[model samples]
Target: MPVAAFAVVAGVIGAGPVIAAVQGDPALPERTAGQLLADAAQASRSGLKPMSGTVMQTASFGLPGLPEVQGGMGGASPTALLVGSHELKVWYGGESKLRLALPGRMSETDLIVNGDQVWLWESEANKATRVKVDAGAHEKAGGHPKPEEALPTAVTPQQLAQQVLQAAEADTVVSVTNTERVADRAAYQLVLAPKDASSLVKEVKLALDGETFVPLRIQVYAKSSAEPAFEVGFTSVTFSPPAAENFTFTPPAGAKVEEKSLGTLVGEHGADRGEGADPTHGRFEDGELKGKIRTVGDGWTTVAVLPVSERDLRTPDTGGQRGQDAGAIADTILKSAKPISGAWGSGKVIQTKLVSALLTDDGRLLVGAVTPEKLAEAAGRK
Candidate 1:
């Protein structure tokens, strides 16, 4: 297995255009649901080179407790960057060569990943962090593979499609509902609807390219909502490989430099993947969520529970210290979390469109792509 190279380029997942049910052209070969998924997985992994596109994302969790996010979200991580619009020019030249140009007030923040050398040049801060990409990709055959470097737990449409197809088949009703276009490329809309009514997610729709079978776009809709609560896709794309210069960058003179390995740079997030069916575990180095991690169930309806310790909650990792006041940050998030109690006991709940988590006062976190009831049930269990 190779290290996934996809990063959170421009985090703004929004409701995409309505994919209408239409007849597929009779001229085109028909594919069964199983066949389409198998082919898509294979195609997404092959011949990915020299591609450039506009990455647009609009996100709205509709959670009241989220600070700085009143209506919607756009950027990545932390609540502060949520609720806005951001567009980034992304270039992908295989897994070793990748680039993202984010415009800023003074200059621009560019992330360049060329081979083992990865550089993040932030013009505003005049800082550059150069690091070696992680070595998670030692193939059994020999040497390293060209697969992308994994970022802080963020997922791409193609990656999500593969994960869902592999792990969520039994838990969801999979179907091809509509034929649509993304970034001017014709695509098939594969819809995955959860069979479990206790899950909050209404459905996950993936638009796979007609020819390549690569997932061009993925949209997740909350239960009862026609529009997607989170979506990401290429607004405009070119299959031709980007120029070599795109993946190379040089920081300005006098810029402060802080270098760390990709693992160190991502803190604990590099290993924490919290998708519904995907199993993941890690200590909360970021002080957001930490504890003895474990999954409660399997498949799309699966839930995860982590027992938070008093020490982990109190400690925050600031650059200098173990971190800023970890305790303070946890306290802030806990304060905002809505309070609730039931047979499963009492806890504060952070409800978002894509995921929901239950934080008990007793220091337990139960999270998943499930409803409150599902989390509560998991919580009540010994």
Candidate 2:
């Protein structure tokens, strides 16, 4: 997970507009913070009823400027994904049928899951990949996995809200702030603020639909900042089941089609590991991760420590353009990182408004939403 994500266990106009459409706190039936949290949590954990909507995501972590890449299907570029306003069309037909489409300039990318079949289509490349969902894995995941779990894509407000609520423990002060309008629907706003002063996160806000208790929007504010640094929300939505056709995809004629299995799609098969697998990448043993990765501290101040080595920096295809792009991005991150030394040892530290990361000289990477000092302290731990 990204350090920013670890910070909260961790958008827009239209849906990205947040409460921009609201004149003031909307008049709604009173509900205590506890009631709101319980309702939202229940809604999230329960089977998702059929729904479709447009989701918008915006990020302003104050990251250093990154190199720009050409647009099109390539617009899915890693750098472009990190900073900008992006929109996605989502369709949830049931537990076994879902679709997400990311439309770009003259190009569109889509992931469609219908029952046991999954299709990934890239319009610009005129290619499609068909994969069979692992029956056991699909059942274990409760039908279909989330988009983030299956592929790299912007998260919906529902997903982010559940994550924030899970992190709202005794270390957080939870309260019902006021009612707001999101997607033109009156919603109860629940705010969660960290009790830890060292945490860079100021608070997380979730807007739950007044009628259904589903989250319509979620915003994360950084310490000392009034505006949200990251947010994702729905601009428009409907509870009616999406058309069945939306879940089906027939690869365009002449489009290249590749076959794969669920494990192959994620490179999780043991055969893909070859001689050895990187512990930092998460080597599983008997179904649980052991020894390689560990967490320090608790709650909002928690930090994750991962063992690293030169091997982690080497690309599988060092001579390819993909490798060059990866190298450039790494260089940019390193350039922005500051040199630091302490009892934890000397290396580089990257601090953003909401998260901090440390790459130590002795092969360790510690990341969290805490201060650089906190990360260093965790690194010093035996």
Candidate 3:
């Protein structure tokens, strides 16, 4: 997990139009802060009923000095939010079926999950990858896996809200503020702020549907900032269950297809299934990571040390000698990184407004929201 993700994530619209207004509605019982927390926690643990709707996500990372990063997706460059107000059509049929669509300029991409199978289809490329789901996965009784676990796409509020519930209670200030309208539905605002002053996060707020108690919107802010740097929420929604046919999919003819088992899709049988429950420290489950991930600090400014792997970074054609080229890829990334030295030793440092990273002489990637000095200190720690 990215350090800020230890805070929150999302997408959005033109900043000017989202000042949510609360219209007169039924008198829903006012919930205390404790009750609200309990309710969110319950929602996280319970099974979601069938529902379908459109969710619009928008993000703006307030990276200072990088004028190239200003434009959200759809623009030429990249922003912290990943892309512009990404609209997704979402569907859920209890626990047995699920589907989502991401509309694009030329073609829409989709994913469908039914029974013990999941399929990801890219219409533009006319390709699909199908994988069998684990029979034991459903029995675990937990919130759905992260979006990356579901598919290589955006995660729904139903899934992300559960993550907040589990992580917030331990180090955050939970409270209830005023109500707002989300997707035209009345909503109760639940705000969570990190108690640690060293945290770059200002706060995270979730908008719970007044009627169903489901989260409709989530926003993340940086410390001392007025606008949300990242946000995702429903622009419109309906609680009605979707038609059964909506959860099914048949790849278009001529499309390429690949099959994989659940373990291959999720790395249950990967190179190293280390003994830890923390997702943030994991780098090589799918094999893109060729390193040992270990945290160098605790709490807000935790620095992560990832040992670089020459094999993972090399091109497929590079073959055998790639292992000997250890820092080759790290060096490529260090082109923009500046040289720096500390008591720990000399290395390269990359600093953005929100994220700071250090590449040590020994091929270790130390990164965190803290400054380079902090990362250097962490790299030197005994």
CA lDDT, every prediction?
Answer: 0.59, 0.67, 0.58
**lDDT ranking from best to worst?**
2, 1, 3
Clashes per candidate, residues 3 or more apart or on different chains: 21, 7, 6
* Winning candidate number (TM-score): 2
Q: On a 0 to 100 scale, what is the lDDT of residue 65 in model 3?
A: 31
lDDT by residue for model 3 over 1-382, one digit each (tens)? 1112212322111001122233234345576543543454345445456788888777665333322222111222222234356678889887778898877677777778888678877776687879876677666756455422421121553344334343333445555654578898877775656565555667777787776667788887777568776787888888788998998888778999988776675553221222121122234445545555788766556788877532333322222322223233334444667888877777778865456878677667787866667777798884
Best by lDDT: 2
Residue pairs clashing in model 2 are 11-57, 11-58, 11-231, 12-16, 13-16, 13-17, 15-235
- The list of candidate 1 runs beyond 4 A from truth reads 1-29, 65-77, 81-83, 114-118, 127-170, 248-291, 309-332, 336-338
**Lowest-lDDT window of 10 residues in candidate 2?**
11-20
- lDDT of residue 378 for candidate 1: 86
* lDDT (Cα, 0-100) at 154 in candidate 2: 23
Order of quality (TM-score): 2, 1, 3
In Å, residue 129's CA in model 3 sits off its true spot by: 6.3
- Candidate 2 lDDT by residue in tens digits, 199-296: 89888877778877777888889996788888888899898899989998999899999988867766622322221212332234333336678999
Q: Model 1, 253-360: lDDT tens per residue?
A: 888888787657555333211111011122344444544577886655578777753344555322322233234445655566677888777877877777888878
